[model samples]
Target: MALIRSILFNLLFFPGTAIHCFGVLAVSPMGSGPVQAIVHSWSRMHYWLLRHVMGISFEWEGKLPAGPYLIAVKHESMVEAIDTLRFADTPVVVLKRELADIPVFGRVTRRYGVIPVDRDAGATALRQMMSLAKQAVVDRRPVIIFPEGTRVPRGARPQLRPGFAGLYRMLGLPVVPIAVDSGRVWPRGFVKRSGTIHFRVGEIIPPGLKREEVEARVHAAINALNLPTT
Candidate 1:
């Protein structure tokens, strides 16, 4: 049953995505707003299909932070990434460098102002990311980054990558850490089971703390979602 549902979802998902992608391409020259609308529409459609077709729903606690602040999220599945668009008007997401060059889809990432991290370039990459992210802040857009750098399985706790702290200090913006348990239901790749995904928003971690202090707070806050609750 799960296999059939997953297959059905993919069939429905890609066609809708193609249509939105073309719409975004047609109107991207207008500005980021139109591009973002297309993206947001796609996100809503994706989540709607997840619920109605696959029996997967979301339980979100806590409000989304105001714009121009950093949103440090727990990356456990692609669901959280897509849902970020649902939170803010047009969030500036930090993604890997490769994703920005994927043929037709790459244009969407570039037009939407996604920060691409070249992990291999080390400090150079960090500087470039900071430059782009600063512009997002100035534009009053919320920035969403997965502090761990990559998705992890449910209950696996990993220290945040160095760049997260760097951005926090350099951007000089309050960071709102969000914890999610989406992976428990939608593990990476094609398989998505029927379950309720929870997004627990933590308190705002203000700027100007030491690197160690900031990392500790963000790490602990995000990992709290993974803790076992009877």
Candidate 2:
């Protein structure tokens, strides 16, 4: 069943990739509103295809926070990234700089207000990320970030990067922690698998908390979600 599903998913990828490419071209000159709307629709379509092709299911716990908040999500599999877009309500993504250089993908990402960070450049990227995050908040858009910096294997714990702290400090908005077991199903790399993906959206950690305190609280929330179910 898994092999069949994988083959079906591979077949679907071609058309989905074409739609994404055309969507990117359609939005390149104007990066706002209609463009973002089109990209969001295409993204959801891609996820829908993925879910059907792979026989994967998801369960999201807790409510999405109201108003502007910094969403710090666990980074485990690429599936989580696509799921984020599929599930969220047009969020402004905070992504790595390398993605911005990709041909079609880059254009679509920029159109959707994805703030790209140069991970190798250190402080400069951090500062720019914070600036873009603040603006997003002011624009009443949620800022989604993967605080773990990079994707890690299933059940492997990666240290949360300091850049998250900087964004939290600079934005001074509520931080919502999201934890998920996406790796269990999709794992890493490009191969597809079949299973349920569990996502737990922790409470919104309000502003005015100390950086370390917020970090610790969010970390604990995600860790708690990562634990065995039974």
Candidate 3:
């Protein structure tokens, strides 16, 4: 099964990327609405193809909050980011600046309203994120961020980044914490794995809370879902 999945993934991955790239090229220079529509379709199709080719399934627990909420998800695998577009209507992703340099993928990501942050520029990145996130929220789009900063291995714990607190406080929006076991199946850098990926969406942490407090709550939520009891 693993070998079959690997073969299928190898065959479909680049082609799917090419399709999305073409979509990006076609939609470039268009307005946000049209661009977003094309991107959204591309994302949905990408997820569908992933599930079909990799035999991966998603099991989401709890509910996703409505508009204007900040979604702080734990990063475990690249699949988590890709799968998010399956659920979020039209989310603005806070991604690393390096992704913007990728050839076709970068162009598609930018056209889809993905906000890139320069990891090397400390304060500057935060300011830019704040400005972009505020604008996205005002435009009625949800902001999705990975609090862990980078992906970790399955069952491994990573420290949350510090900028989330500043962004949470500045945006003054409710933060929804999401935890997932995508790393177990996708297992970063691996070719393919066939299994179900679990996602647990926790309660929304309201705004005006202290930075440490919010961080603690988000951490607890992720830990709770990661626990064996679930």
Candidate 4:
């Protein structure tokens, strides 16, 4: 039954996503609003498919920061990344540079002004990412980054990657770490399970701390959310 549900969801999802992306490109040229409209619509469609087809739902705890704050989010599944549009009004999501090669999806992300980080390029990639992120901040858009660099399955506790600390210090913006348990239901490889995915926003960690302090604080805050309740 789960397999059937996952299959049906994917059948609907891929075409639906492509249509929305093309529609956004046609109707609203060079605007984040329409690009975000594409994101918002797709998020709604995804959750609806999850609920109706896969018997899954989601909820959020704690409010997302109201203004131009930097957000370091828990990377657990693709669901949280897409649902970011639901949290902020067209946030600048820092994602892998390779995504830019994905045909139409690449074009849409470029339109959305997403920050792409190239991991293999080391310092050069970090510089490129930070430069774009700074411009996004100056434009008064909130920035979202996955501190762990990539998705970690439920219960896997990887250290926060280096790019996060660099961005935190260089951007000079207050950081709000967000945690979510989306992987429990929406695992990385696409077999969707039934459960409520929870997103919990952590307290704002003030800027200007040493790299060690910032890393320690943000790491604890984010990982704390992944732990089972006492």
Candidate 5:
């Protein structure tokens, strides 16, 4: 049954995502408002598919921060990535450089504006990511990033990549860490179990703290919902 639901959801998700991407591209000249509406609608459609076809739903705790704040999120599966759009107000997401290198999806991400981080580039990548992030702050757009750099298993607690601390220091925006336990149901497999993924927003951390302090605090906060690993 889970396999059938997963297959059905993907059947709808992939084609629908492609249409949403192109829809944003077609309305690019109309500016950010229309593009954001289409983007939000895309997320809405995704959740609808999850609920109706897969019997998956989500719940949130803590007040979602208002204004342009640095949002640090746990990356357990693709579920939280899309959910970021639901949490923030039309924010610019910082994602892996490879996602921006894909064929069709690449063009859409570029058009929508993302801070693509190339981990292989070391200092150069951090510099570029900060540059894009600074502009996001200037535009009063909230910035959402997976501080772990890549998705971790449900119970894994890895220290955040340095780029997160860099953004925290450079952007000078208060950091709000969100912990997600989505992998139990949204595991990277052909089957998706029916369950509720919990999202917990931690207390906001002030900016301008030393790198080590900020990183340590965020590391603990974002992993608040992580299950104990064997």
Candidate 6:
């Protein structure tokens, strides 16, 4: 049953997404407003399919703070990445350079002002990211980055990446850390199971602390879901 549902979901969702991509491409010349509206629609379409077709839903622990701040999210699956776009304020994500180069979607990422991180580029990449992030802050758009730098399996906690700290200090914005338990249901496999993905939004961690202090607080905040519940 799950397999059939997954098949049906891909049949509808993928084509629907492709059409929206083209829609974004056609309206890119107008401005960021039109572009973001199209992306918002695409994110909504994905959630609609995720719920109706796959029987998956979301449960948030706390309210997401107002934007123009940093959103440091737990990286478990692609679910949270797509969910970020659902924000009406429409954040500019710091994602890998490869992802930003993905055919048609890559074009959308650039047009929408995504901060593409070239991991191998070292300090140069970090400086470039800070520059782009500054522009996003000036534009009043929230910045989203997977502090771990990439998706990890459930229960696995790694130190926050250095670039995350670099951006934190550079932006000088409070960070809202969110822990997610999506991999249990939204695994890397093609067939997905029906379940509620929990997003545990932690309290705002203020800026201006040293790198170690900031990293420690955020690391704990985003892995709150991994703590043993007695």
Candidate 2 to native Cα RMSD, angstroms: 2.1
* Tens-digit lDDT string for candidate 1 (70-109): 9999998878888888776689999998888887677888
What lDDT is reached at residue 85 by model 6? 87
lDDT per residue, candidate 3, 51-124, as tens digits? 88888888889989778788988887778787678688689998888997698788878878777878778777
User: What would you estimate as the lDDT of candidate 2?
Assistant: 0.78
lDDT of 2 by residue, 84-200 (tens): 776676788888889877877787677678889887787776677777787888789888888888887776667788888878887888888998887777765556688788789
Tell me model 4's lDDT, rounded to 2 decimals.
Answer: 0.82
For model 1, the run of ten residues with the poorest summed lDDT? 221-230
What is the TM-score ranking, best to worst? 5, 6, 1, 3, 4, 2
What are the runs in model 2 whose C-alpha is more than 4 Å off? 27-31, 228-230
Give each model's whole-structure lDDT: 0.87, 0.78, 0.79, 0.82, 0.87, 0.87
Better model by lDDT: candidate 2 vs candidate 4: 4
Q: How many backbone clashes does every candidate have?
A: 0, 0, 0, 0, 0, 0
| Model 3 regions lying over 4 Å from their true place | 227-230
What would the per-residue lDDT of candidate 5 be over residues 51-147, giving only the tens digit for each residue? 8898988888988867899999999898879878876888899998999999878877877779998877877777788888988888888999999
| 1 or 5, greater by TM-score | 5
Worst 10 residues of 3 by lDDT: 221-230
**Of 2 and 3, the candidate ranking higher by TM-score:** 3
TM-score of 4: 0.92
Deviation of model 6 at 162, angstroms:
0.7
